[model samples]
Target: MLKLGVLASGRGSNLQSIIDAVEAGELSVEIEVVISDNEDAQALERAAKHQIEAQYVGPEDYNNNQDFEQAIIDDLERNDVELVILAGFMKLMSPYFIEHYQGRIMNIHPSLLPAFKGLHAQQQALDYGVKVSGCTVHFVDQGMDTGPIILQAAVPVKEDDTEESLANRILEEEHRIYPAAIKLYAEGKLEIEDGRVRIAK
Candidate 1:
């Protein structure tokens, strides 16, 4: 089974999805640890409920981004994590950290990537008047949300949709596809080539 380290900074809805999949025996992976920069993050509580190792690594304690990332790396290595999942980690990873895990880290973004690459992605889609909006699971690279796409699920943008409404719809798809992407990685069915992801048979 693949061993996973998860990073999150919020309510952990996506993290809950992964835990649900594992508990239901739908995913073949082990959550070695769940680390959060925010001490108050609900992700930590979720992990604790599942009896998984949950830790708080405050970025404030470190002098710089590199030191913060190094602390995270040390925690991950100590747990023997094979893959890193960024469920909703608010910070952008430094190149130093990205290189250390390269192609071994995954993140779920709220918009069909290559579009709305950063925060408030649902608002971006609504502002652009897109007929369709969705979520993406992709590899984590040096650039913000510019990594190779692994999987995506599209949700129709309703004409009267508010940012919150559209975001909630997209979030459902996020909860679905993120774990599916992790499953593919766990099964050795994902390959990266020339900045794209290929799913194996």
Candidate 2:
């Protein structure tokens, strides 16, 4: 089974979805541990509720971004994590850490990525008057949400849609496709080529 280390910063609704999928036997993977930069992150609580190892490594404890990432890397290595999933981790990973994990790290972004590639992506879509918005699961690289795309699920943006409403809709798709993307990776069905991901049959 694939061993996973999840990084998150906030409510971790996506983490919950992954846990539910695992418990339901919908995916063949082990959530080895969850590490958060926020000590009070609900993601840690969710992990504790599931009896998975939960850790809090705040950046304040470290001297710099690289040090903070190194702490996380140590924890992940200790747990023998094969894959790293960023549900909502607010930190930008350092190039050193990205090189350490390389293609093993994945993140779910709330926009049809290569568009609205940074924070508040839902609001960006709303502000841009886009008719369609969605979520993307992609490999994590040095750039902000500019990694190779794995899977994306689109939702129509209503004329009356607020950022919150649009985000809520996109989050539903995030919960669905993030796990499906992990399953695809675990089954060795993903191949990265020419700045994109190719799903193998």
Candidate 3:
């Protein structure tokens, strides 16, 4: 079974979805541990509820971003995690971390990706006047949301939608697709070539 290590910095609804999927036997992976930059992150609470190890390693603890990422590497190594998932970790990981994990790191973004990456994706879509918005689960790289996408789910951007409302819609799709993407990765069905992801035939 694949061992999953999660990095999150906030509410961790997406993390919860992964945990639920694993517990329900939908995902053939075990959540080894959860690490958060925010000491008060609810992701810790979720991990505690599931009896999984939860760690809080704030920026102050590290001398630099590289050190911070090294700490994560150490933690993942200790847990023997085969895959690292970034659910909502706000901090940009060091390029070294991306290099170390390579294809093992994955993340979910609230946009089509190669689109409104970095942040405020819903607002960006609204401002850009796009009628359709969505969420993407992609491999993590040094560039923000620029890695090969594993899966995506489209959501309609309504005319009267506020950022919060639009985010809510995208989040629902995120919960569905993120787990599906991870499952694909676990099943060895994802193929990346020329920056595009193809399901193995």
Give the alpha-carbon lDDT of every model: 0.96, 0.95, 0.93
| TM-scores vs. true structure, each candidate | 0.99, 0.99, 0.98
Let me know the TM-score candidate 2 reaches against the reference structure. 0.99
Better of 2 and 3 by lDDT: 2
Instruction: Give the higher-TM-score candidate: 2 or 3.
Output: 2
Which 10 successive residues of model 3 have the least lDDT summed? 192-201
> Pairs clashing in candidate 2?
none
Backbone clash pairs in model 2 (N, Cα, C under 3 Å; residues 3+ apart or in different chains), count: 0
lDDT of 2 by residue, 38-96 (tens): 99999999999999999999999988888889999999999999999998999888899
Q: What are the C-alpha RMSDs, in order, of all predicted structures?
A: 0.6, 0.7, 0.8
Q: Write the per-residue lDDT of candidate 3 for residues 130-194, one digit (tens) a residue.
A: 99999999998788789998888999999899999999999999999999999999999988898
**Which residue segments of model 1 deviate by more than 4 Å?**
none
Q: Runs in model 3 with CA error above 4 Å?
A: none
Clashes of each: 0, 0, 0
TM-score of 3: 0.98
Q: Encode model 1's per-residue lDDT on 89-157: one tens digit a residue.
A: 999999999999989999999998899989999999999999998999999999999999999999999
